[model samples]
Target: MSGKTVIARFEQGKETFEILVNSDLAYEYITGKRKDPMSVLDAEEIFKDARKGERQGEEKIKKAFGTTDMATVVDHILKKGDVPITTEQKNRLMEEKRKQIIDIIARNSIDPRTNAPTPALRVENAMNEARVSIDPFKGPNEQVEAVVKKISLILPIKFAKIKINVNIPPEYSNRCYGILKQYGLKSEEWLSNGSLSAVVEFPAGMQTEFYEKINNATQGRAETKILE
Candidate 1:
C-alpha cells in the first residue's frame, strides 16, 4: 500500500522550514520504529506528531531574525492538513462526552408534570413530541417533506401517516400554525369558522399513539378532528 509523502512546514522569526516524510518515516517518527503504511487515521496522527517535532527545530531558526512575519508563520502551519492530538487532549474529549451522556440520562429520568419522579421518564415522554418544524418555503407539502426528511432520525415507525385535523381561533391562527409546524405539519386557511384547520401527518397509524403525543405536547388543548 503506497501513499504520498507529507511535507509539514512551519516558520520562525524570519525563516520557514519543512519536514518531509514518507509513510515509513512517519511511522518511525511516531512509534520510534518503521512499519508498513497503515490506516489513514493512524498515518495522519503519526504525521501530526512529526510536524510537532519539526516545529521545535524551526523555532531555533527564528531567533536569527530581528522581526517575525505572522502571516507567513500561519501560512506555513496551514500547509500541514492534520492536527496532532495529545493524550491530555484525548482524555479531555472523553470526559466531555461522558458528562453529556450523564446529563441526557439524568434529563430523561424525570417526570415533567408531577415532578414526582426521575428525569429519565420525563425525557422519554418528551421525545414523542420532539419534532422538526416544517419549512414553509416548501409549500403545502411541508409536513410531507418533514416526515420524509426526519423519519430516519426517529425510532422505527409504529405505523404510516396518521392524519390529524386541527381548528384554532382566527386570532390565534398563527400561533396554532406555529404549534402544528412544531410537529412538522403545514397549516392552510380553512373556510369553516374562519378558524384554520391544519392537517398533521405522522408515521404512527394508531389513533392512540398520535393523540397521546399531540395531547401531551399541546397540553390537551390542541383539538384534533380526525378525518378517517
Candidate 2:
C-alpha cells in the first residue's frame, strides 16, 4: 500500500525549518503511540540523492532542518504540523471532550470534602479553570489520565472500576434489558420464569448514577449487587 505524507515545520524568531515524513508515523509520534521522536527519520525520504555520498546527504538534511542536532529538529517537527484544523472544528471537539470529562466525573468521582458525587457543573467549571488541553483526534477515555492530572489541581478525584450483578423480574426484564446492555453487560441468562440476570462491569465512579438509572427503569424492582 502507498504511504501518506505530512510536513513538519518549525519557526523561531526569523528562522524556519521543515521536514517531510510518512503521515502515519508522524501521527504515531504526536499521539504518544511512538516512543522515539528520531524514529521519524527512519522513514524519512526528504533527502533522496543516489549520486551523493552518505555524508553529503546527511549534511543536506541538516541544512534543510537548519540544525545539526537531530533531537532539536525532531522536537520542532513534533510541535508544528502541516494540517490545520479550523477554529469551529476545534471548539466542537473541545465541547465533546468537555462533556466526556463531565460525564466521567459525574459517574466516577465524589467530592472528598463532602463524600457526595461531584456535580457536573462543578467539574465543568474546574476543567475550564484548569485550561485542560483536549486532543481532538483522541478519544476522551484515552486522554483521561492526562486530563485527570490537570483537573486534579482544582478538584479532588479518584477513579475506580466496578462490576455489578443485576436481576430483573419478568415484568421489567424486557423493558430494562436494553439499558443494562449499554453498561458493559458481560454475561446474561434468562431464568425459567422469564426473568433476566446479568453481570455488568463499568467504572466505579458511575455506580451511583447507574444504579439509580436501573432502579428507575425497573421501578425499584431490579436487584443489584456490586461485585467489586
Candidate 3:
C-alpha cells in the first residue's frame, strides 16, 4: 500500500477527478499527484484554464471567488488571497484625515458677507474684532486695521507662521499700525515700503475683504494675488 493522500472532488453532475500525493512529500507538484487514472489537470493547468476560455469565464470565476467585480475579486483570490489594509492602517488614515481637517480650519476663515470663516482665520478675525470693539471708538481706518490685526495676530500664534500684506497710504498707515498695535500685535516686520505696503502674517484664507479693499483704498493701484 502506498502512503499517498488523495484529493477528491465531485462537481454535482460533472465528472470527478482524484488527486494523490505521497504523505512524506516535502515539495509541491506543478502537476497534480493523481492516485486515480482520471486526473487530467494540474494546479497550474486549472488556474490557467480559470483565467482563459469558457471553462472559467469572467462571471463564473467571480462567482466562485465570491466577489462582486472581476477586478478585485480575481486579484484577491488569485494573487493576494486576502484584503490588505489593517485596522491600524485605517486608524492612521483617519488621523491623517483629522489633521487635514484641523489644517483647513486653522488656515481659512469665513466671509463677512457669507458668515463662514475657516477655523484659524475665524479665530483671528473674531478675536481681533472683539479686541478692537473694546477701544471705545471706531472708523474706516480702525475697522480695516482691526480686521487686519485679527488676521495677523492669530496666524503667528495659532499656525506659527504665515505673512500678510497691507497697502495703505502714510496718512492711513499710521492709524492702521496704531490699530494693529493696539490689538497686541508687536512687530514692525509687517510694515513694508514707503508706498503703503504693510506685510502681516496669517494662514492661507480667502482674502475677500483684501481684494475689495485694495480697489477701494488705492483706487486699483494695489493688486492682490489670489490663488485658485
Candidate 4:
C-alpha cells in the first residue's frame, strides 16, 4: 500500500461494496489510461466498510456479482464504483473533456453564416462565453449536442453536413449501398418493390461532388431529395 488511497464504492439493490485503492491509479484505470484494475488496489480485498476494513463475505459477493473470483470482483468494483477524488483532479479531468468537445465541434461543424469551418479558438471562446459546464466522466460524444446547443446561443454555429434521402433501383441498391456507407448512411430500409430507400449525409463542401458520383454510379436512375 502506498497509503495514498481513497475508498471506491459501488452500491445497488442488495449490493454494497467498497475498496481502498490509490486515488490517482483508480482515476487512470477508470478513464482507460490504466488497464490493470488490480494494480490500482492498495490491498486485494473487498470491504463492506473500507474505513473499518470489514471484509465482505464470498457468498454475498457471488450473489451480488455472479462470481466471487477476486480479479473479477475487483474489476467490477473499480469500474462501477465511485472513486472519490480531489477537487483539483476533478477540475483537470473536466478541462481535458472540454477540449475533446471543442475539437469534435470544430472538426465537423461550421459557421452557418458563411459555411466556413469555425476556428477552434472561436469555439472555445463561445464555450466560455456561454459558460457551458462539461461532465468529466461522460464521454465527449454524449455531451457534444448539449454543448453545441449552449454555444450556438452565443455563436453562429451549425454542423457542416447535408443529408439526402436517396432511392436506388434494385439492381443498383446493392452496389450503391457500399458507396452510401462510405459517405454516411444514416437510416436505410428496403421497399416492397425490392428498392432501397436510405438517407446519407456528407460534408456540405462535398455536395456537388456527392451528387455527381451518385448519379454516375446509379446511371441517373437513383432519385434523391435534400433534407432540411
Candidate 5:
C-alpha cells in the first residue's frame, strides 16, 4: 500500500514541498467524501519520534512538506495539485450529479406562471440554456439552489417548500406511516382514539403523486390539510 501512495506537490516562491498520502484517501478527499485531506496523513507517527528528541519523523515530514504543520500541508493539497482521478471518471461523476439535480428539480419545482410541475426534460434544457455549471466536488443539495436560480431566468420556475398535516385512521396508520416517512415527515403523533397525525414537508412538485399514494394507502380515510 505504501508503494501505491500518491504524492501532492506544492510550491511557493523558491521553495517546494511534496507530501505523501494513500491513494484511496486522496481520492476520497478529492471527491468530497472526506472534509480534510491532511487527516489521511499519519501525522501522529510522523511526530512520534520528535517527542522523544529523535526528530527522525519530524525531519522526514519537514523534508516532504517544508514544515511539520499538517494543517498547512492539507490546505496546500486542497488549493493546488490535480485530483488523482482521470478526466473520464470526473466527467462520469459530474454527469451522475447532474442527473440527480435534474431529478430533484423535477420532483420539487414548478413553473410559477402555469402552476404545474416542471418536466424533467424542460428542466434539463433550461439548465443547459442557462449555462448552469454543476460543481463536480459539491453534492447535489449544495449546488441545486444556485443552479435553480440560474435556470429560473430562462423559465418561470420556483422550488416550493410545502407543509402538510395529515391524519390517518388506525386501520391505515401502520401501513401509511412508512409511505409518509419517505416524503420527509417532520413530526408525528398518535391520537388517543388510535389515529395517527403527522406533519410532512416536501417539494410541491410531488404533491399530486404524494397525495395519490397517501389516498391509496388510507383508502380515502386519510385527511390531509395543506398548511400555509
Candidate 6:
C-alpha cells in the first residue's frame, strides 16, 4: 500500500481513539478488502491524541472498544472512524464514483422530450457542469437522485417507468416468459388458447431495446400495447 502515514480517528462515549496508518491500506481495511487491520497501521499503539504522542491506556481502550485486542480495536477505528485522505486521492475516488453515478442516471432515466435515454456523453458533460458534489465514501446509488436533480435542470431528463401489455403466441409463450421476467414481468396469465398474456413494467429508456428483444424472440409476431 502507499506508505503515506495518516491518522484514523474514532470517538466513543467519552473516549477518542486514534491510530497512525498507511493511507492506502487503511482505505482497503475500512472497505473490508484487507482483513488484517494491523497491517494498515504505522504504529501498534492506540492514542488519545496521536499528534501529541499521548498514548491511551489499555483499560480505556478496552472500555471504548469492548476488547483491547489490537486487531479488533484497530478494525473498529478504521471502519467506524474518519480516516484522513489526501486531496489527490479524494479527487480520484470522486471521479470513479462519478462514473458510477452517471451510469445509474443514464440507464434508468430518459430525456422526457424524446422519451429516450440521453447519450452517456451528454450525462457526463452535465455532471461536469452540475453544481452538486459527490461523496467519496457514500455509494454512488445513494447520490444518483441528487445528481440527477441537478442535471435535470440542464438536460431534458426524467425518471420514468413504462408498463406494457404483451401477448405471446402459443409457440413462444414458454420461451418468452424468461425474457419478460428479465425486464420485469409484473403479472402473467395463460389464456385458454395456451398463449401467454403478461403485464411488464420496466424503465422507459428500455422501450427500444425491449421491443427489439421481444420482437426478435417471436420473429416479429409478439403483440404489445403501451399502458396509457
Clash numbers, per candidate: 12, 3, 12, 0, 0, 0
Give the winner by TM-score.
6
**Best to worst by lDDT, what's the order?**
6, 4, 5, 2, 1, 3
The residue-by-residue lDDT of candidate 1 on 28-98, one tens digit each, is 33332443323222232212135465333333434533223533332234322232334554354344433
Structural similarity to truth (TM-score) of each candidate: 0.30, 0.54, 0.23, 0.59, 0.63, 0.67
Candidate 6 lDDT for residue 165: 98
lDDT (Cα, tens digit) per residue for candidate 4, span 47-159: 98878889888888888889988778887877666768778878988888999888888767768898766778999999999999997667788999999889887888777
Stretches of candidate 2 off by over 4 Å are 1-82, 86-89, 108-117, 135-139
In order, candidate lDDTs are: 0.42, 0.69, 0.37, 0.83, 0.74, 0.85
lDDT of 6 at 91: 87
The residue pairs in collision within model 2 are 107-205, 107-206, 108-205
Off by over 4 Å in 1: 1-48, 51-162, 202-222, 226-228
**Residue 216's lDDT in candidate 3:** 60
Off by over 4 Å in 6: 1-6, 10-22, 29-81, 86-89
184 Cα displacement, candidate 2 (Å)? 1.9
Question: Which of 2 and 6 is the better model by TM-score?
Answer: 6
Candidate 5 per-residue C-alpha lDDT over 1-228 given as tens digits, one digit per residue, 9 for 90 to 100: 332454555544554445556666666666567787666654423322222433235555577567867776565554464335556757866888899999998898878887677888999999989888877756798888888888887877887877899999988888998988999999999998889999999898898788999999988889999899
lDDT value, residue 72 of candidate 2: 66
Global CA lDDT computed for model 2: 0.69
In model 3, which runs have C-alpha deviations exceeding 4 angstroms?
1-162, 178-195, 223-228
Q: Which candidate is the best by lDDT?
A: 6
lDDT of 3 at 164: 49
Each prediction's RMSD over C-alphas, in Å, is: 17.5, 9.4, 22.4, 7.0, 6.9, 4.7
